[model samples]
Structures are given as C-alpha cells and as structure tokens.
Target: MRILVTGGAGFIGSALVRRLIAHTDHEVLVYDKLTYAGVLSSLEPVASSNRYSFVQADVCDAEAVAKALREFKPDVVAHLAAESHVDRSIDGPGEFIQTNMVGTFVMLNQALGYWRGLDEAAKARFRFHHISTDEVFGSLGEEGFFTETTPYDPRSPYSASKAGSDHLVRAWGHTYGLPVLVTNCSNNYGPYHFPEKLIPLIIIRALNGEPLPVYGDGSNVRDWLFVDDHARALQAVFETGTPGETYNVGGNAERKNIEVVTAICSILDRLRPKAEGKYADQITYVTDRPGHDHRYAIDASKIRADLGWTPSVTFEEGIERTVVWYLENQAWWQAILDARYATQRLGVA
Candidate 1:
C-alpha cells in the first residue's frame, strides 16, 4: 500500500516512516510542516529509498493537503501531525488548538473529498487513521485502566485539542460514512525523540553534568510505549483495523516520573559512569505544571485481542536502548541543541 504519513518528520511519525520503508513493502510519502519539533534528519535512514518521499507542508493548509492527496494517491492517510508537548501546551495553547484541532478538521475534509472521488475498491481500501494520546482520557486514580469506552476528560491544552480531534474523526466516520480509524496510545519514548521530553531530557542533561529536573513530587505515573513498538501498532491498526473503531495501544509498563528519571540515571551510570558520584545525585524537584495529570494507563487488551499487536520492548530494555542511542549519536541531538532548544524548562503557567 502507498501511505501518506502526516508529521512523518517528528518523533513517532519518523519512526513509523522508517518502519514502513525498512520492514514493509509499502511506499511512503511524508507530509510535514517542519515545526520546531519536526527534524528532517530523523528520516535519514529511509530518505534514499525510491519508495520513500517527502513533502514539506502544513496540514492546516487545505490546498497543500489536497495537492498531496491528489498526487500521492495514498491508500492510507495516517494523521500524526500535532503540537504534542504537554508543558509547551501549558505555556502556549493557541498553537495546540490550531494545529491539533483545526489541522485535523482540514485533513478530514480533504480526505473525505478524496475518498469520494475514488472508485468503490479504492474507497474501500482507503483509511484515515487518527493517532492520539491516552491523555485524552485525563488522569486515572491508581487501579483502573483507560479502555476504549473511557470518557474523555482532557485536562491540559494538548490533550483537550487532541480530544477534539478524535471526536472530529469519529464524527466524519459516523456522519459522512468515511472510513476512519482512531488509536489512542500511551507515552512514547525511544530513538530520535525530541530532547524536550522526559527520557531524552534526563539523558541529555545527565550527560552534560546538569541537573535533571523532576516536576512536583515526581510521582506522576505514565505508561511508557517504545516508539518502534508504537510504529508497529500503527501498522497493525491501519492495515487491518475496523473503520470507525478505536484502539488503545500501550507498553504495559507503568512507572512513576521519579522512577523513569532514576532508571535513566542507572543506565547512564552503568554505560557512562561519572568519575565520583551517581547520575541520580543531580536529580532535583521543581514546581509542577498547571493541570498536571496524576496518572495515565491504557487497557490494550482490545488491540492485542483484535489485531494481535503488543509492545515488543519492556521499559528496562527500551530505556537502555534509548540511552545507548543518545550516547552513540551525540551529533544527532547536539545539532538539535545547537540549532533549537537547549533542554530548558517550559510550561511554567
């Protein structure tokens, strides 16, 4: 199948693109806006392949989206573009609303038109897979997990915008008879992750002998899905999932925020030990961001049962691999720090 992946230059999107190019027979076209988070170098592995192509454009631009649809003529439109950082969302929400909410609307409208023009077989084969977050279900207490039937209670600007987009996708499917699939996934971490996120930030800062910042009490819990595993789950969903259905993808590995940070420290201490002390010594707690969710966990049984997709990497294995990747590929992240963000704190509001 020919797939057009929006936001394919970003972390998870790029991972999906690489997976498609390397592991599958599908041709790929990446449509990205090159936002600060979108790094072209992430696609370096598959850029040389004749089956891999890229178009630098925004999902909010209807004409550009339509042009890509018309030219690429993709069998699947995997929508992954959005402003995804929670802290950044707290700092500035307008961008999230515009990109995550309005951008999805534009994509759906264009996709609906494109699907309408296709023949019966082509239309039947087409899919608009909306990739989303488990945060859309808001915070969990301690025991229960978020299922496909969980009610949305988005607390942050980022999750709220994503929740709106998810609703829009389902609306398109229900109202227009468009073939749409939605997947709400847990937190993703792995190779080529933007440095601003927790795992990468801790790794980069710890490597530089800088303080590793933890928010509030550092007890916030999150389910950690490896990006490569997530890319695989995406493939499973779009390739075989039922249209108008939602799948919850997870790593089945839960850890507190402090645990996540210290785990990174442990890995670094083993691989690149400090001369005198442990990397965990640099850990410091700071004020938490506004409307911070206490916990998020996904009930991935539906996906596992229906599509036979499960996370292939455990937290320990995935984290160690991630730390090693950063250590060996300093040039990749150093270029990012040199050009854009410097691992500073955000979302102070």
Candidate 2:
C-alpha cells in the first residue's frame, strides 16, 4: 500500500513510519513541517529505504497537502501531525489551534476531495486514520478509565484542538462518506521520543544529575503504552477497523507520576549509578500545571477484543528498555538536546 503519514518526523509519527518501513511492504511518505520538536534526525533510520520518502511542508498548507495527496495517490492517509506538548500549548495556544484544528480541517477536506476522485476499488480500500490522545477525556478522579465512548472534556489547548480534529474526522465520515478511523491512545514511551515529553525528559535529567521536576504532589496517574505496541495497534485499526468508529489503545500499565519517576531512578541507579546518590535524590516539585488532569487511563478493551491486540510489555520492562535505549543511543537523543531544542521547561511562561 502507498501510505502518506503527516507529522512523520514527530515522536509517534516517526516511530510509526519506522515500523512501516522496516516490517511492512507498504510505501510510506512522511509529510512534516519540521517544527522544533519535529526532528528529521528521528526519521534517519528509514532514510535509505526505497519504500520511504519525505516532504517538508505544513499540514495547514492546503495546496501542498493536496498536491502531495494527488501525486502520491496514497491508499491510506495516517494523520499524526499536530502541536502535542500540553505545556507548550499552555504557553502558546495559537500554534496548537493552527496546527491541530486548522491543519486537520485542511487535510480532511483535501483527503475527501482526493478520495472522491479515486477509482471505485481504490475508494473502497482508502482510509483516513486520525491518531488522538486520551487526555481529551479530561482528568479522571479516583476510578474509571477512558473508553471509546467517554465524553470529551478537554482542559488544555492541546487536547481541545485534538478533540476538534477527532470530531472533524468523524463528521467527515458521517456527512461525506470519508473512510475515517480514530484512535485515542495512552502515554507512549520508547526510543526516538523527543525529550520535551515526560519519559525522555526524566531520563536525561537523571543522567546529568539535574533535578527531576514532578508536577503537583506527583499522585497524578497515567496509563503508559509503549510506542511499538501503539504502532502495531494503529496498523490493525487502519487495515480492518470500521470507518467512523473510535478505538482506545493502551498498555494497561497504570502508574502514578511519582512512581514513574522513582522507577526511572531505580533503573538508572542500578544500570548507570552516580557516585553521589540515587537518581531519586533530584526530585523537586513545583507549581502544578494549569488544569492538569488527575489521571488518564485508557479502556482499550474494544481494540483488544475487536482486533485481537494488547500491549506485550510490562511498564517495568518498557522503562528498562527505554533507559537502555537512551544509554546506548546518546547520539540520537543528545543531538536533539544540544540542537536548538532543549528539554527546558516548556509552557511555563
């Protein structure tokens, strides 16, 4: 299949592209704007593959995205492009609204037009897969998990924009007969992850003996899904999922914010112990994020039962592998940090 993946240089998009190029016969084209967090270096692994190609452009550019779609004639369009950092969204929401909301509108309209012009068979086989986040469901109190049916109550600009996109995808499917599928996934931690996010940020700070910042009292909980697991699930949904339907993908690995930091510290303490003290010694709590959700856990049972899929890695195992990946692949991540983008606190203007 010829697949066009937007935001292919970003964290999850790059990971998905690597999996497609390495494991499948599909031809993948990466469409990215190369924002500060979107690193072409992340897409370097698949650079040499004949099945992989890339274009530097913004998703909001209707003509560019349309031109690519018309030329590539993709069998599938996986839309992963967006400004995803919540804190960054807090600091500068205009970019998030532009990229996530307006960009999706342009892509959906362009894709609908392209799909209408395809051959009957190609139209039947074509798909527009929209990737989303569980944060759109808002903060959970003490119990319950976010299922495919959960109500969207986005608190931050990041999630609000995403929620708008999700609605657009579904509305396009319902109103215009676009073959669209949406997946809201949990926290993803693995290799090639930009350091601005939680896992990599904690890992790097621990390595440098810098303080590991914990928001609030660190009791906020999250369901952590490994990137590879989420990628595979996305493949399944795109291939066999019912258009207009939504699926929740998760690792079922729920852990408190503090527990996650502490686990990272413990792993580093054993694998790359410092001379002074444990990595946990650097823990520092600051002001909590505005509208920070108390917890986000995905009820991925629909995807599990429907597609026969589930995450294979335990949180402990996933974190261990992730730590080792950073340890061994310093060139990949260090270049990211020393480059114009550092893991310095974002969204805290």
Candidate 3:
C-alpha cells in the first residue's frame, strides 16, 4: 500500500514512517510542515529508500494537502501532525487550536473530496487514521483506566484541541461515510523524541549537570508507550481496524513523574555515570503547569483483543534503550538543541 503520513518528520510519525519503509513493501510519502518539533533527522534512517518520499507542507493548507492527496493517491492517510507539547500549549494556545482543530477540519474535508473521486474499490480500501493522546480523557482518579467509551474531559489547551480534532474525524466518518479510524494513545517516549518532553529533558539536563525540573512534587502519573511500539500499533489499526471505531493503545506501564525522572537517572548512572554523585541528585521541584492532569492510563484491552496488538517493551526496557539511544546519538539531539530549543523551561504560569 502507498501511505501518506502527515507530520511524518516528527518523533512518532517518523518512527511509523521508518517502520513502514523498512519492514513492508509499502510506498510512503511523508507530508510535514517542518514545525519546530518536526525534525528531519528523525527520518534519516529511511530517507534514502526509493519507497520513501517527503513533501514539505502544512496539514492546515487545504490546497497543498489536496494536491498531495491527489498526486500520492495514498491507500491510507495517517494524520499525526499537531502542536503536541502540553507545556507549549499552556504557554501559547492559538497555534494548538489552529493546527489541531482547524487543521484537522481541513484534512478531513480534503480527504473526503479525494476519497469521493476514487473508484469504488479505492474508496472501500482507503482509510484515514487519526492519531491522538489519552489526555483527552482528562485526569483519572486511582483505579479506572480510560477506554474508547470514556468521555472526553480535556483540561489543557493541548488535549482540548486534540479532543476537538478527534470529534471532527468521527463526525466526518459518521456524517460523510468516510472511512476513519481513531486511536487515543498513552504518552510516547523513545528515540528521536524532542528534548522538551519529560524523558528527554531529564536525560539532556542530567547529562549537562543541570537541574532536572519536576513539577508539583512530581507525583503526576502517566502511561508510557514506546514510540516504536506505537508505530506498530498504528500500522495494525490502519491495516485491519474497523472504520468508525476508536482504539486505545498503551504500554501498560504507569510511572509517576518522579519515578520517570529517577528511572532515567538510574539508567544514566549505569550507562554514563558521573564522577561524584548520582543523576537523581539534580532533581529539583518546581511549580506545576496550569490545568495539569493528575493521571492518565489507557485500557488497551480493546486494541489487544480486537487488533491483536500489544506493546513489545516494558517501561524499564524502553527507558534503558532510550537512554542508550540518546547517549550514542548525541549529535542527533545536540543539533536540535543547538538549533531550535536551548533546553530551558517553558509553560510557566
């Protein structure tokens, strides 16, 4: 199959594109806006393949997206482009609303137009897979997990915009008979992750001998999904998932924010230990972001039962590999830090 992956240069998107190009016989055309988070280096592994191609364009640009759709004539449109950072969203929400909400509306409409022009067989086979976060379900108490039937209670602008996009995708499917599949996933962390996120930030700051900032006593919990695992689950859904249905993908590994930081520290201690003290010693508490969700856990039973998909790595194994990837690929992340982000704090209220 020929696949057109939006935001394919970003972390998870690139991981998906790389997986498709490396493991399958599919042709992939990566459509990306080259946003600050969309690093071309992330796609370096598969960029040389003839089956892999890239187009620099924003999902919000209907004209450009339509042209790509018409030219690529992809069997699947995997939409992953958006302003994804919660802290960044808290700092400036307009971009998130414009890209996550309005951009999705544009993509859905353009995809509808493209699908309408296709033949019966083509239309029947085409799929639009919208990738989303579990944060749309808002904070969970202690016990329950977020299922596909869970009500959306987005608290941050980031999650709210994503919630809006998810609604637009389902609405397009329900109202227009478009083939759409939505997946709400837990937090993703692994190779080529943008440095601003928790795991990478902790790794980078700890390596620099700088203070590792933890928000609000660092008790906030999140389900951690490896990016490679997420890429596989995405492929599974687009390939075999039922249209107009939602799948919740998770790693089943829940860790407190402090636990996540300290785990990174422990891995660094083994892989690249400092001379005197441990990396965990640098952890410092800071004010939390506004509207911060307390916990987010995904009940991935549906995906496992329906799609026969499950995460391949535990958080312990995933984090160790992630730290090793960063250590060995210093040039990859260093270039990003030197160019775009300076490893500073953001989203302060």
Candidate 4:
C-alpha cells in the first residue's frame, strides 16, 4: 500500500511513518506544513528509506492536497494534521478552526474528487481515515468511560474543532458513500514529543532546575497512550477496520495530572538524580487554563475486540522509557528549544 500521511512530520504522525517504513512494505509520502509542533527531525530514523518521501505543505491548501492525492495515488489517506494543543487553542482558536475544521473539509473534498476518478477496484480499496481525540466527548465525572456511542460535548476550541471534523468525515461517509474510518484516541506521550506538553515540559523544566507548573492543584485526570502503541493502532485500523466505523484507542492507563508530573519526577530521580533535592520539589501549582476538562478515559474494548489492538506499554513503563529518551537525546530537544519554543506557558485565556 502507498500511504499518504498528513502531518507525518509531527510527533504521532512521524511515529506512524517510522513504523510503516521500518515494518511494512508500504511506501509513504508525508505532507506537512512544518508548524511549530511539526519537527522534521522526528522522521530522521526512516527518512533514508527509499519508501519514505515528504512534502512541506499546509492541509488547508486545496490544490496541494489534490496534487498529493493525484500523484501519490495512496491506498490509504491517514489524516492527522491539525492544531492540537489545548492551551494554545485557548490562546488562539482561529488556527484550530481553520486547520481542524476547514482543513478537513479541504481534504475530504479533494479525496472525494480523487476517488471519483479512480477505477472501480481502486475506488473500492481506497480509504480516508480521520484521526481524532476523545476530548470530543468532553469531561467525564469520576466513573464512566467514553465509548463510541458517547455524545460529543467539546468544551475547548481545540476539541470543538476536532468534533466538527469528525462530523465532517462521517457526513462524507454517510452522504457520499466515501470509504471513511474514524479513530478517537486518548492522550499520547512518548519519544519525539514536543516540549510544550505536560510530560516533556516537566522533564525539561526539571532538568533546567526551573519550577514545574501544575494547573489548578493538578488533579485533572487523563488516559495515557504511548505514541508507538498509537501508531500500531492506526495501522491496524486502516489495514483491517471496516469503513464507516469508529474505533476508540487507549492505553487503559489512567492517572491524575499531578500523578503524571510526579511520575516523571520519580523516573528522573532514578535516572538522573539532582545533586541535593528531588525533582518533585520544583512542582508549583498555578491557575488552571480556561475550560480545562476534569477527566478523560476511553472504553477501548471495541478496538481491542474488533481490531485486536492493545497498548504495548503500561504508563509506568512508558514514562520510564520517555524519561530515558529525553535524558540521552538532549540534542534533539535542545535544537527545538534553540530554534522555536522555550517551554513557556500558553493558553492563559
């Protein structure tokens, strides 16, 4: 299969590209905009492979998307491009709406046009898989988990835009008979993660001997999924999942925000201890971001039962590996800090 992965230079997308190049015979073409979150170095491992190729372009450009589809002639169009930071969304939502909502519309329209031109057999084999977040279900109380049947109650600009895109994908499938697959996944963390997210932010700040900010007492809960595990789930879904179906992928590991931060501290303490005090000592509570969700957990039973997909690593094990990666690959992250972001707070609105 020739797979065209949008946002393949970003963290999770790059992980998927690497997996495809290293494990499968599928050729890959990466279409990305080189956004602040998109790091070309993330694809370094598989860039040398003859099966891997890249294009620096925005998903919002209809002509570019159409051209990629016409040229690459992919069997699967895995759509992962979007503005994905919650805090950044709170700060500026227009980008999210444009990229997540309008960009999806562009992708669908181009894909639909391209699909129409294909022969019957090629049309039958093609698929448009939209990758999404469980945040579309909004916040959960304490007990229940989000299932495929859960109603969307997106609270943040980021989630609202994603929810809109999910709807667009389903509409394209239901109304036009487009072969589409949707997957809503839990939180993803692991190697090559941008420094702005919680785990990596805590790790970098802790290493810099700076305060690690925790929002609103740090009790918000999230289900953690390893990036590689997510990449595998994606492959399984596109390869075998039925069109017009939605799968919820999760690591099944839940932890409080404070717990996540402290877990990173514990791993750092064991791997790279501070001279005098522990990394946890730097943790400081700050004002929570507006519309912060209390909890998000996924009922991954459907994906596990239907696709035989499960996370490969526990939260503890994944975090340890993540910490070790940051420790050993200072140059990778240092280049990011030097070039683009400096681990500052965002989404103050």
Candidate 5:
C-alpha cells in the first residue's frame, strides 16, 4: 500500500516511517513542515530506501497538500502534523490555533476531495488516520483513566487546538462518510525526541551538568508511551481498524513528573555519572506551567482488546535505551540543538 504521512520527521512520525519502510511493503511519502522539533536526521535511516519519500510543505497549504494527494494517490493518509509543544503553545498560541486547528481543516478538506476522485474499489480501501493526544481529555482525578469515550476538556492552548482537530476529523467522517480513524495517545519518549520535551531535556541538561529544572514540586503525572509502541499501534489501526472508530494508545506506564526526572537522573548516574556529586544534586524546582492540568492517565483496554496491542517496553527499559541512544548518538541531537533551537526555551522566560 502507498501511504502519505504528515509530520513524518518528528519523533513518533519518524519512528512510524522507519517501521513502515523496514518492516512492511508500503511506500511512504512523508509530508513534513520541518519545524524546530522536526529534524531531517530523524528519517535518515529510511531516506536511502526506495519505499520512502518526503515533501517539505505545510499542512495548511491547500495547494501543496492537494497536489501531493493527487500525485501520491495514497491508500492511507496518516495525519500527525501539528504544533505539539504545550509550553510553547502557552507562550505563543496563535501558531497552535493556525496549525493544529485550521491546518487540520485544510488537510481534511483536501483528503476528502482526493478520496472522492478515486475509483470505487480504491475508494473503499482508503483510510484517513488522525493522530491525537490524550491531553485533550484534560486532567484526571486521583483515579480512573481516560478512554476513547473521554470528553474534551483541554486546559492548555495545545490540547485545545488538538481537541478541535479531533472534533473536525470525526465531523468529516460522520457528515461526509469519509473513512477516518482517530487515535489519542499518551506521552511518547524514545530516540530522536526533541530536547524541548521533559525526557530528552533532562538527559541533555544532565549530560552538560546544567541545572535540572523541575516544575511546581514536579508531582504532575502523565502516562508514558514509548514512541516505537505508538508507531506500531498506528500501523495496526491504519491497516485493520474500522472506519469512524476511535482508539486510545498508551504505555500503561504512569509516572509523576518528579519521578520521571529522578529516574533519568538515576540512569545517567549509572551510564554517565558526574565527576563529583550525584546527578540528582543538580535538581532545582521552578514555577509550574500556567493552566497546567494536574494529571493524565490513559485507559488502553479498548485498543488492547480490539487490536491485540500492548506496550512492548517497561518505562525503565525504554528510558535506559533512550539514554544510551542519546549518549551514543550525540551528533544527531547536537545538530538540532545547535542549528534549529539553542536549547533555550521559548514558552518559559
């Protein structure tokens, strides 16, 4: 099958593209805007392969998207393009609204038009899979988990925009009979993740012996999913998932913010310890994010039962592997840190 995947240079997207190119017989065309977090190096493994291609265009550009659709004539359109950083969204919301909301609107319309032009059998096999986040379900209480049926209660600008996009995808499927599948996933950590996110940021800062900043006592909790697991879940859904259905993908690995940071510190202590004191000595508490949700936990039973998919790695194993990857592959991330973003944060001053 021929697949068109947007945001295929970002962490999870690149993982998916590599899996498709290496493991499956599908031809993949990556449509990515190549923002600060989106690095070409992430897709380097599959770039030399005949099955993978890339487009340097924005999802909001109707002309570019429409042209790509017509030329690629994809059997599956995997939508993963968006303004993904929550803190960045807090700093500058206009871009998130434009990309996550309006961008999705444009992509949906273009995909619908392309789907209508396909022949009968080809049209029946076509799929539009929208990748989303569990953050759109807002903060969780002490118990209970977010399921596919969870209501939208986004607190931050990023989550709100993603929620809007998810609604639009469902509306297009219900209103126009478009064959669409939406999956809302938890936090993903793995190789090629941008330094802006918590896991990578801590690892890089720890390596440099810089102060490791923790937010507001760092008790905020989130379910952690490995990026590779998410990519596999996406492929499973794109291939066999029923149209107009929603799935929740999670690692079932929930950890508090402080625990996540501390765990990284422990891993670095073993792998790349400081000369003098322990890595945890560098920990510092900072102000919390504005409008930050308290917690997010995912109920992945639906996908597990239906798709027969579960997280393949324990958070400990995944984090250790990720740390080793960063330790050994300094060149890949250094280029991104030096050229694209200087490791200074934008959303926080």
Candidate 6:
C-alpha cells in the first residue's frame, strides 16, 4: 500500500513515517511544509529507503495537494499538518486557523475529488485519516475522561482549529461519502520531539541548567501517550477502521504538571547528574496561558476493546527513553537551538 502523510517531518508524524518505512511493506511519501517544528532531520533515519519519499509542500495549497495526490496515487492519506503549539496559538491564532481549519478544508476537498476519480475498487480501499487532539474536549474536572462522544469545548485557538478540522472530515464523510477516519489522541512524547511542548521543553531546559517553567500552581494534568504507540494505532485505524468513525487513543498514564517535571528531574539526576543540585531545583512558576485546560484524559476503552490496541510502554519507561534520546542526540536538538529557530520560529516568543 502507498500512504501519504502530511506533516510527516514533525514529531509524531515523523515517528509514524519511520514506523511505516521500518516495520511495514507500505510505501510512504511525506508531505510537509517544513515549518519550524517540522525538522527534516527527524526523518533522516528512513529517508534512504526505497519505499520512503518526501515532498515539501503546504497543505493549504490546493494545486500542490492535488498534484501530489495524482502523482502518488496513495491508498491512504494521513493528515497531521497543523500549527500545534498551544502557547504559540495563544500568542498568534491566525496561523492556527489558517493551517488547521483552512488547510484541512483544502485537503478534504482535494481528497474527495481524488477519491471520486478513483476506480471503484480503489475508491473502496482509500482512507483519509485526520489526526486530532484530546484538548478539543476541553478541561476535565476532577472526574471523567474524554470519550469519542464527548462534547467539544475548545478553550484555545489550537484546539478550536483542530475541532473545526475534525468536523470537516466527518462532514465530508457524511455529506460527500468520503471514507474518513478521525482520532483524538492524548499528548505524545518521544524522540525527535521539538522542544516547545511540555516534555521536550522541560528536558531541554533541565539539560541547560535553566529554569523549568511550570504554569500556574503546576497542578494541570495530561494523559501522555508514547508517539510510537500512537503511530501504530494510527496505522490500525486507517487500515481497518469504519468510515466516519472517531477513536480516542491514549496511554492510560496520567500525571500532573509538577509531577512530570519532578519525574524528569529524577531521571536526569541519575543519567546526567549536575554538580550544583537536582534539576527540580530550577522549577519556577509562571503565569498560566489564557484558557489553559486544567486536565485532559482519554477513555481509550473503545479502541482497546474494538481494535485490540494498547500502549506498550509505561510512562516511566517512555520518559526514561525520551531523556536518554535527548541526552545522546544533543547534535539533533542543539542544532535547532543554535539556529535560533527554537526561540524565533513559529512565533514562539
């Protein structure tokens, strides 16, 4: 099978691409805009494979997307391109609206057209999978987890835009008969992650002996999913999932903001011990971002029961491996920092 993955150079997207190239027989073509977070280096491991290829293009460009679809003739289109950082979205929301909402519209339209032109057999086999986030379900209180049926209460521009895209995909499926699948996944962390989000940011700052900023009272919670496990779940959904259905994927691991930072410090204390003190010593509280969700957890029982999928790596195991990756691959991340892209790119500051 031939699969086209948008935003395939970014953290989770790159992990999915590498998984397809390394573990499966399918041919993969990565379509990425090379945004600040979309590092081509992340895809280096599988770039040389005969089954792997890449085309630098924006998802919002209709002609480019159409041309790529015609050329690649993919059996599946995995849409992962978007402005994903909530902090950046808070600072500037226009990009998130444009890329996540408008870009998805363009992709869905192009996909519908392409699907219509396919042979009946090919059309029957084609799938358009839209990747989304659990943030769209909004902040959970002290209680329940987000299910596929949860009402959307997006608080930030990033989640709002993603919520729009999720609707577009389902709308296309219902109104136009496009075979589309959507997955709202929990926070993903692993190697090749850009250092803007929580886990990577903490790892990078801890290594630099800089202050690790925790928002508010540092009590917000998130269900963390390993990227590789999420990638596998993606493949399963695209291959066998029912059209117009939504799946909630999660790690079943929940941790508070302060707990995560403290855990990272504990890992680093053993791996890259600093002479001064523990990494946790650098913790500093900062003003919480506007509309910061208090908690996000996914009830992945549906996916577990129906698809027989579950995250293999525990949070402790995943975090340990993640810390080890960042430590050993300083060249990969340091290059990003040296280029000043970490601070300057994507309206990060």
The TM-score obtained by model 4 is 0.97
Candidate 5 per-residue lDDT, tens place, 1-349, comes to 9999999998889999999999999999999998876899889899899889999999999999999999999999999999899999999999999999999999999999999999999999999999999999999988999988877899999999999999999999999999999999999999999988999999999999899999898999999988999999999999999999999999999999999999999999898878899989989999989987888899999888998999999999999999999999999978877775444555422
TM-score for predicted model 5 compared with the true structure:
0.97
Which residue runs does candidate 5 get wrong by more than 4 Å? 341-349
Candidate 2: segments with Cα more than 4 A from true spot: 341-349
**lDDT value for model 4:** 0.95
Query: RMSD to native for every prediction?
Result: 2.4, 2.3, 2.4, 2.4, 2.1, 1.6
Best model number under lDDT: 1
* Model 4 Cα lDDT, one tens digit per residue, 1-349: 9999999999899999999999999999999999888999999999799999999999999999999999999999999999999999999899999999999999999999999999999999999999999999999999999999999999999999999999999999999999999999999999999999999999999999999999998989999999999999999999999999999998899999999999999888888889999999999999998989999999999999999998989998899999999999999999998776344444321
On residues 255-285, what C-alpha lDDT tens digit does candidate 1 reach at each position? Answer: 9999999999999999999999999999999
lDDT for each residue of candidate 3 in 110-209, tens digit (9 for 90 to 100) = 9999999999999999999999999999999888999999999999999999999999999999999999999999999999999999999999999999
Q: Rate the local accuracy (lDDT) of all candidates.
A: 0.96, 0.92, 0.94, 0.95, 0.93, 0.94
True-vs-predicted CA distance for residue 182, candidate 5, Å: 0.4
Encode model 2's per-residue lDDT on 161-237: one tens digit a residue: 99999999999999999999999999999998889888899999989878999999999999999999999998999
lDDT of 3 at 166: 99
- Provide the global lDDT of candidate 6 against the true structure: 0.94
Backbone Cα, N, C clashes tallied per candidate? 0, 0, 0, 0, 0, 0
lDDT of 6 by residue, 1-349 (tens): 9999999999999999999998999999999999877899999999789999999999999999999999999999999999999999988899999999999999999999999999999999999999999999999998999999999999999999999999999999999999999999999999998988899999999898899999999999999999999999999999888888899999999999899999999999998899987889999999988888999999999988888889999999999999999999999999988766556665654
Query: What does the lDDT come to for candidate 1?
Result: 0.96
TM-score of each: 0.97, 0.97, 0.97, 0.97, 0.97, 0.98
